[model samples]
Every structure is written in C-alpha cells, then in structure tokens.
Target: MEVEKMLHMKGGNEDTSYSKNSLLQRKVISMTECIIKEAITDIYCATNCPKTIVMADLGCSSGPNTLLVSNAFINIINEISLKMGHESLEIQIYLNDLPGNDFNTIFLSLPKFVKNLRKDLCMSNPSPPSCYFNGLPGSFYKRLFPSKSIHFVHSSYSLMWLSQVPHIQETNKGNIYMSTTSPPSVIKAYHQQFKSDFSMFLKCRANEIVSGGRMVLTILGRRNEDPCSKECCYIWELLAMALNDMVIEGLIEEKKMDSFNIPQYTPCSKEVKDEVEKEGSFTINCLEVSEVNWDANTDNRLNLPDKNGGYNVAKCMRAVAEPLLASHFGESIIEEVFIRYRKIITERMSKEKTQFINVTVSMTRKA
Candidate 1:
C-alpha cells in the first residue's frame, strides 16, 4: 500500500474517461428508468400541478440527453393527465445539476426544441401538454430540492461520481485508487465512501421525495470476479500505460499526477445494497446490472484525432489525470492523446467488442 502511494506521489493521470450521452447511453439509462415511469404515471393522475405536482432531473447534463429525459417525462405526464381528464394543468419541470454544468447550452437549445415538438404534436392532431422549464443548480448530495417538495426525481450517469474527491494523503496508501494495496482494504475504503455518499444522497432525496414520490438512478458498474481489475476495459488501462510510459521517459513527474482522484462513488452492487437497505425509505422497484456493448463506429476513423472524440475520451477526465499529464503534455496534446487513444481503443474493440456495465435502481419513496 505504501509503495503504491509513493508511485502515485510520483505523478500520473488519475481519471480519463469520457461521458457523452451516446446511443449506448440512451439504451442503458432509458432501460434503467423505465420502471420509474410506471410509478409516476399513477402519481401524475392524482394531482395535476397548479393543483399540486412537479418533477426534476438532477444532474441533467446539457445535450440531447436532457431532451431524452424531458420527452420521457412528457409521455408519462401526458398519459396520466389524459387519464385523469385534466390535460390543461401545466406541468413545470426543473432541470438541475451543479452550477458548473453547461445549463445555458441546454436552455439555449430548448426553445427550438419546444417549437419543433409542438409542430410534431400538431401534425399528429394531439393537444400538446403545457409545461414550463427552469434550470436549478446544486449538488444533489447536499440540498437539491426544498423539504418534501418534489413529486419525482431522475438522475443518470452523474450519480456515480462524487461531488468531489474523498481521499487523504496518508491513508490513501495504495494503487492511486484503493486506500490500501490489499484488495480488501481498497474495496473497503471504496465501500465506506459509497456508503457515506449514497446515504447522504438518500437523506437529501428523502426530503425532496414527497410521501409517494419516485426516483430513478443509473450508474456505471462492472461484472465478473475481477471486476475491479485495471484491465476491465483495455482502453482505460492503455491510457494509463501510455501516460506511465511518459513518466519513465522523464516527460512528467508523478506527484503532479496523483494529486487528482476519481471522485469516489459506489462502484458496484454491495455498497448500493448497504445504503438503500439501511435507508429503508425507498422500495426498490427494479435493480438490473448488466454490460452494455460498446461498438462505436471507429472503422474508418480509428486513428483519426477528432476533437469531440478527444473530449469524450479524456479531456473531460483532466481532473483525474492532472498529476500525470499536465506537466508534460500540452493542453493542446488532447488531440495527440486522442490519436493514441483512438488507435488503442479501436484495436481493443475490433479484437473483441468491449462491454461496459451499468447498475440501475428504480425506487419509490415510502408513503
């Protein structure tokens, strides 16, 4: 454990994973939240807000993903309102995330989206539901919504990352990842952190989810006995190796690298079970964890250094690998890194389609 700490102290990139709401993202997240829609359909029938109701998408990143969320909510609301014979009551939606999120980008795109959507509904000869959209900012782990004030909440992909890093220099004595070199200790520290963070999330959420409110969460996860192995995804391990080789070449020092960490969040099932079971305020409606196939079309574009691809693969991960690369690679080297990253990831995928897993939990608040 101590040896690992010294190596991390030498400097390296701590994180370099990209998150774009891709086709794969849609399949995984939507599947995860499908159950939440079922519960919310009933709730929406009971109270069309203005009479009493609202919904929120926590950590809603700026992009088509936001639209995906909104559309899903719309379908649920439409169905419920139609059933209750109260289609005129406007449903207000709050798109929320940390203030650092690109919410402006999301909002900027929304007006056109609404117009287009209205046009579509008109063509179908259906009365379009009325609604209002607003952006709210806050760390969901802290205070997200007012006390007992939300009817439904949805957050995807974002819950797996903590609001900030949670490791100490001393006890963080292992593989730039684990708190200790021993597999058990590393897993323990990770579980401990997950237990704390998730419980905090539940407590805050408890305040927001009215007596019978609902929530849907989708998180990155893994399967297999060696789920924690560095090689779970060759692309990630290769990136680390590429950066590690640079360290040996005297390109970057180690201390600058270890300074960053992958903000801790529950990585697997055990920790999630611990927190949710302990909270007892939510009833799990669905818990499905499986690997999603990752076969992005890198055929002709394998070695191509695309900018968005670079951002997706690593630039977003600058915080994780800041110690490893910043001193040596130019900020502009994002392209070069993409060149190498693309080559390796494509090779791995072509060899055998790589798969990444997600753990989804759809729960309803206890009344």
Candidate 2:
C-alpha cells in the first residue's frame, strides 16, 4: 500500500478528529519535556550559542500538539538565555508530516497559536526570540532539509509507522499486525523493515542535522523482545478480532481481512539501540520506557464500553487509524468496527490492565 498517501490521522477539529482525540499524544509529549530541555541546552552550548536555531518536528499532526514542541523550545531557550546572560535567539521551526496530513488545520490555527505563544513568552522574558513557523509536507524517511542545517529535531508517536508494509511471503491470516499467531517469518520481516526504515531515518537526519545537534523521538514500543507482546501489539490484535467478527457476520469479506496489514512496528529498546548503532550516524543519549493507560485522559476508568472510558479509547484509536482502514478496507465499516472495538477494549480492560508502552530515545548527531 502507498502508506505516504494513505497514512494520516483523521483530520479537522471534529468530534472524532485527531485534534480532539490526541490527549494521549499530548501526554507523551509532556513526558519528554525534560529530555527536550536537556537536548536543547546541549545544542545551545555545543553550537557556541547559535543565534538562529533551526528545529523541526517530524510527523507534526494537526491540533494543539502540533505546536507544543515549538513552545517548549521557546520557553527552554529563553530560560537558557537568562541563565547564561545571553541575548534572545531567533527560532525557526519546521512542522513536517506526510503530504496527506492535515496541514490546513495546523496552518489555520497558527495565527492564534503564535499570539498565545508570544503572550506567554512575554510574561517570562520581555525580549523573547523571534520564532518563525513553516509547514513542510514530506516523508521523514528521506531528506527534508538542507545538509547540516537543523539544530534540533523532535518526533512523538510517529516513528513506529514504517515507510510501507513489509512484503511477507505468506499471508498473515486473521491479524493485521504481528501477533502470537503470526509465523516466525512474519516477525522477522517486520524487524528487517523497521531496521531499514530506521537506519534510513538516522542517515537522512545525519545529513540534515549539524554536528552536536540533538534529536528526541518517542515511539510505541515494548519492553519484551517478543514481537507479539501485549504491550505493543494487543491493540491491533483486538482490532483484528473486531474485523474477524465482522467477516463472520458478513459485514466484511474474509479475503480483505486476510490481505490487509498495518504499516507499523513497535520495537523493543534493544531493537532501537541496535538500529542506531548500525546506522552509525547518531549516538543514543538516553532510552527510557513509559506506560500510558489505554483509557487515559478520562475519569471513567472503572467503566467499560458502556461508559465514557472505553468509548474514548475507541475514538482515540479511530482518530489515528481510520484513514488507514478506510484506504484499505473501505470506509463503509469504520463506525461498526470501532463499536465492536470499544466493547472488546472495555471487556479486556476490565479483566486485565493494558497500557501502551512508549519508548523515548534522546540522541545527538555524531561529529
């Protein structure tokens, strides 16, 4: 499948859009604030306190989280300026995503976003940096900036997506991602694909990032080496179960289910470290894992699908995965699939606690 064209979060500021359902992503971003601050501090010192700092946030999907990275930089840099008794710096930010991403929504929100950002900065520092925003639409797997230009880079909840689905020799029946039932070859294929894509990402960024520049990335990941571990793959497994039920009920074709697979991977920490070492362009600074509840950002945690918790989880997943499903399975079953998914999540969460394992890695460009 053409993932670049088909892979995008549900757009706009609607009830089910990514803008409304991205609190989980916001939480993930917040979790990395310290790492981001450290990286920025190091970059500032290493680059001799650059006056013009160019940064990019890859896979910057639309919504409030879209500008969160820039805001963090502005605040952190201003703090650094005060500590070092240096003048305010100029900040240039490039917001990047796939061509199909909702850049329009982000652009439309920019006027108010900047005004609020500046107002907040004024309270902290009278002379805040002059920040500029640019929307660049492209795949991060390839070059997106001039060589040795960007001073910092940040991406959250995005690297797990492969450039495209792995080409397996056999059909991964009854599953859309690596699962316990998947054959050994299926897991190997996914690992190889992730290695290739991640290596390319590092290599591309190596060219784009100046020496001493830093990058911080957050990905859906697993603590265990097992590809089929619940931490990483259970959500998709539940989604596949919903699809299988629809197939049995004549709502969707079994053939379609058998043919489809997600172009994503949840790597273990070892996998990430290995890929970075193999790529030979960046040095891993820190790698840590955190867990987020499936039913986060809501108080109705005890209730299942019948209440708000499970329903909210389902909506969040839909906001992120609906476009991929619509492109491959047809948009007709989107609503029904999520309805079943919500119930499954509620039942499972009631019996057992399931959470998304997020792997956050901070790295510096090799000199």
Candidate 3:
C-alpha cells in the first residue's frame, strides 16, 4: 500500500490527529522511563566525556510524547554533567520521523520546549549547557547521519511498521493484518519482511553510532513466539470485523477490502534478539516485555458524559489508522467505519479486556 507515502499518523491538531489521540503511546514512554535513564547513564559511563553529545529520536511523531524522551535525556545529561563538574557540555538533539509526518506541529511547539529547558537548567547552573535542535525527515531504514556521529538513539511504538506490505495474500481474503485465520504463507512473508528490515536498521545504526553508543527501543510486540498470537493481532482482527460489517452493509466494496493490508508486523522477543545478534554490530544489554491494557490511556474520569469505552478506543485508533484507511478506502467512509468499530470494541470490552505486549530492549554498539 505504499507505506512510506501513506503510513503516517493523522496530521494537525484536530480531533483525529495523532497529537490528540496518543495517550497510549505516552503511557508506553512513561513505562519505559527507567530504561531510558539507565541507557543515558550507561552512555555517560562508557564514553569519554566529549564536550558535545549528539542524540536522535527516531519516529518522533508529532505529540507531547515526541519530545518527552528527548527532554528526559537532556535533563539526565545535565545532572550528570553538573555532578561530574562538566557544566559546559553541549547537546545536539535531532527529532526524526517519516517524510509524511506532521513536522510543523513539532516545529511550532519547539520554542516553548527550549524555553522550559533553559529555565529548568538555570535553576541550578548559571550557565546551562547549550542544546541544538533539528528536525530530520526520512526513513530510518536507510542512513540518516554521518558515521560515528550519534551517541544515542531512541524509538518508541514504531519499528513495528514495515517499509511496505510484505506480500499480497489472496488466500487471506478477509484480513488486513496477520490473524489466526491467515495462512502460513502470510506469516512467513511477514517474518521475512521484519527480518530484512530490522537487519538493515541495525546496520545503518552501526555506522552512525559511535563505539559504545547505546540505543533503547520500546515497540508493540508479542510475548508468544507465534506470529499470529491473539495479543499481537487482535486489534487488527477487531478492525477487520468492523470493515467486514461495512462490506455487508454495501458501504465498502469487497474487492477493495481484499486489496488492503496493514503494513505492520509485531515481532516476538526472540526474533528481536536474533536480529541483533545476527547484525554483528550491537550487543543486547537488556530485553524485557511488559503488558499494558488496551484502554490503559483512556481517561474515564474526564467529564465527558457522552463518551463510552468503545468510543474512546475508536478515537485512539482513528488518530493513528485513519490516514492509512482513508488512503485505501476513500475518506467518506471513515466516520461510519469507526462508528461500527466503536460498537465492536464496546461489546468485546463488556466481556473481557485486551492487552498489548510491549518489548523494550537496550543495546550498545560494539567497539
């Protein structure tokens, strides 16, 4: 489905924009805060204290969370510098995302971020470390920086998206992603895609990151080794059910549904570790999986009397998937589709809650 051109989150600050519906992603970031801190500390300890530190956040989609991790690293580095009596350190921070991402939102919000950063640093040190910020637009699957330029790299809730659909499966007629009903051929295609993409990712980073550089990645993944495990694919399964209902109602054509497939894959922990080991450039320092409820970020206490659990979930999904679906099915059917989606999720939640398995890994570039 030309993922590089169409797989971005909804842009702008509207109701369905990723900026408004990324609470779940923010929660994932919060959950991984300790890992991030530890990675930064390890970087400080392993590398010679260079006067300038360079860092990049891959897939820094537009939202509060875009800078959340970067801000944390800056603060941590500042504290470390002050304690080590190196207050003059400078930091260059790069925020990266796909070309189709809403970079303007992040650009507009940068002044305030810089202001707050300066204010926070001034509270302790009279002369705060200088931080330079730049926005890089491109795919991380390829090279994005000069060799040995980056000291740290971070990505969250991304990397699950493949560069493109692995292969078209006419046999998997009713599904848009991997599901229990999908054929073994479909599963094999997805695994091969991830293996190639992840290997390229590590190779590119190996050239860009300095020796002893660290990277911490947190992505939606599966705990079970099976690629079609329910925990990894149920969200798409419910989404497919919603689309099938639309097809029956004559709102969407069956042929169009047959052609659409989500360009995403959730790998198991073993798969991630295997790729890292095979890439021959990075050592896996730590790998852990955490579980989060599907509705972990939904704020039920909000005074919105009309919002139901299903509706909230629908909003979150719409914020991320609307662009991709609209590209395929046309925009006219989005609202109706999500209405049905909300109903499906609501009924399902009435019986049981669903959860996402999150994989967090820390690695260091080999000397």
Candidate 4:
C-alpha cells in the first residue's frame, strides 16, 4: 500500500492509539468515532452506498493511548459494517502526524494490538469493527490523503498548534504570542492561523470525503468570554512567570524573546464555530464543551503517592508543557517550574477539579 510508504517517508510515524482517560486525545477519537459511525450508517441505510470508508486520525502521537483509540474505532466501524452487511467493506485508517513523532513506539506496539483485536473478535459474541489501519505521516496543513479518499477526519489538540512555528517579528521588544496575552491582535492572529489551516483541511478533504464526510476537531480552548483570562490556562501563566524570572535574572535578552512563541494557539469554541460556519464548506453538527482538568488530583495511591505532592493542581498538564519548559527553561528548570505549576494546579483543583475541558466540534461536508 502506498500509505505504508507514506508512513516511512520523512515525516512518518506509526499510529499512536489513545485511551479514554487521555482527556483531549481520547475525546477526539471518541468524537470522530461517533461521526464516522453516524455518517456510514446513515449513507448505507438511506442510499445503500458502497461501503468503502476511509478514515484518518491527525496528530496521533506514540503511546498506549493511541492504540486505545484505534481499538475503539475498529470496534465501531466493524459494528456498522456488520449491520450494513458489508463484510468486505474497506475501512482504511490513517495515522498522521509531523515528521518526527515517535514512530518506533507505534511500530513496536501494532503487532500486539492487532493480535489482541483478532483474539477479541474471535471470542466476542458480537461482530468486529470493519476497518484497516495505516500510518500516514505528514503535516495536516498539507495534502496527505488522496483526493476524495477520506470518509472521516479526526484531530485533537493538534489543530491548536500551527503546522510550523509562526514567524514572530520583535516589535517594540515584546513577544508576539505572549506580549498581547489575549489582546485583540493575539487572538486575531491565532484565529487567522486556525482559519487558514482548517480551511486547507476542508479543501483537501472536500474531494476525498465523498459527498457527506464528517470531520471532528477537538482542541484546548478558553471558557471565559475573554481570551485573556488568567485562569484560562495556568500553564501559560506559569511559563510567563518563568520567562519573566529568566528576564529578571538576565539569562536571556528581552529583545530575543519573541522567538520563543509556543507553536500553539487555543481559541475559544465560539470563535471556532463562527469561523466554520462562515467558511460554508461544512455544516456544524455539534459544538461540545468539556472540562479538561489536566491537573493532578489527590489520589495518593502507593505508586502515584500524590506524585507531585500538592502539585496535583497541575494534573494532566505535564505532558505537553513539559517539553517546552524543558527546552526554553533548561532541563534544570523544568523540575522547578513543574513543582511550582503543580502547587498552583493542586490548590486550584481543590476548589474546582475540572476546568472547562477541550471542546469537540463536529462538521459534515456540504454536498
């Protein structure tokens, strides 16, 4: 299959499956899984269309969580396939990400996952999900899938980040993304990037998604009407503080700071809904707001033992924030920064365990 070659290319990686507890990751798969089942079943029931279904998961990173999502998708597709009496229907699944994702983990885990799925299929009383899986490697901003080849497209937390780092020119010696801190220009720039990337995704998928393909996008976003709310993301706040501390210490010059933009942007759901509706390429099926308490909780099991101590406040943030903090703040500072962040998250969660989590927006292409 050419998709296999696609996986081995410069920006290739094995498909990372995600688990339900992964908050944003699991939710993205869940949203996609729902829409795919609905789209396939509806088309088959109404028009008795051919059952060749192509599905793609964007920004699937390496880990057990990736496989978990894959398994759920396969199950759903297989159930739909059986109901439609299309045992031989093609369910081509694609795992897409940037060039440097951890493909080794995906490659190593696939055999075991497939074997387990087959075993479960044989033993289960119910029919299995009908689908074939492939790892399609590349930036989602570019054309990865063939024209009109995809039936469903899924991405989580990924779309919030730009395909490449946004160029930030130092104006008046301030970081572009951070200096504004939810200023009109900052939000506008982020919204623009999202519109561009998402619009491109629709254009590429328009040809591939048959007449009624579905796309589900889940991302970290703000609940407050104001994008600049401090509570929106304590992670960003902690980083800002860390950077400020650095500046105070004379570790890095203020003039060179703008280059350190967090290659990511989290726009509000309302902003996203307006943009998709305005694009007119697709119809909005639903926009859901869920809490994403990535911060730690107070479950002091023997193993976890409140691992971060009172830092449970910073619960689930360690995954994404760790890399950036490590990179800019230095390996030595990550532990310190996280310690402080956790202290804040722990206290914050005590009052409210979950901040409005990621929002999953589902849309179907217009015929």
Which has the higher TM-score value, candidate number 1 or candidate number 2? 2
For model 2, the superposed segments whose C-alpha errors exceed 4 Å read 298-307
Model 2: lDDT of residue 238: 93
For model 3, where is the 10-residue window of minimal lDDT? 298-307
Please give, for residues 33-58, the per-residue lDDT of candidate 2 as tens digits: 89999999899889998889999999
Better of 3 and 4 by lDDT: 3
TM-score result, candidate 4:
0.78
Ranking by lDDT: 2, 3, 1, 4
* CA displacement after TM-score superposition, residue 3 of candidate 2 (Å): 0.1
C-alpha local distance difference test of each model: 0.60, 0.90, 0.89, 0.58
lDDT of model number 4: 0.58
- Over 4 Å off in model 3, which ranges? 298-307
Candidate 1 deviation (Cα RMSD): 6.8
Error of 3 at 296 (Å): 2.5
- Which prediction has more favorable TM-score, 2 or 4? 2
Provide the TM-score for each candidate, comma-separated.
Answer: 0.78, 0.96, 0.96, 0.78
lDDT for model 1: 0.60
Task: Write one digit per residue (lDDT tens) for candidate 1, span 315-364.
Answer: 43433343334333446545455456556654554455455667777787
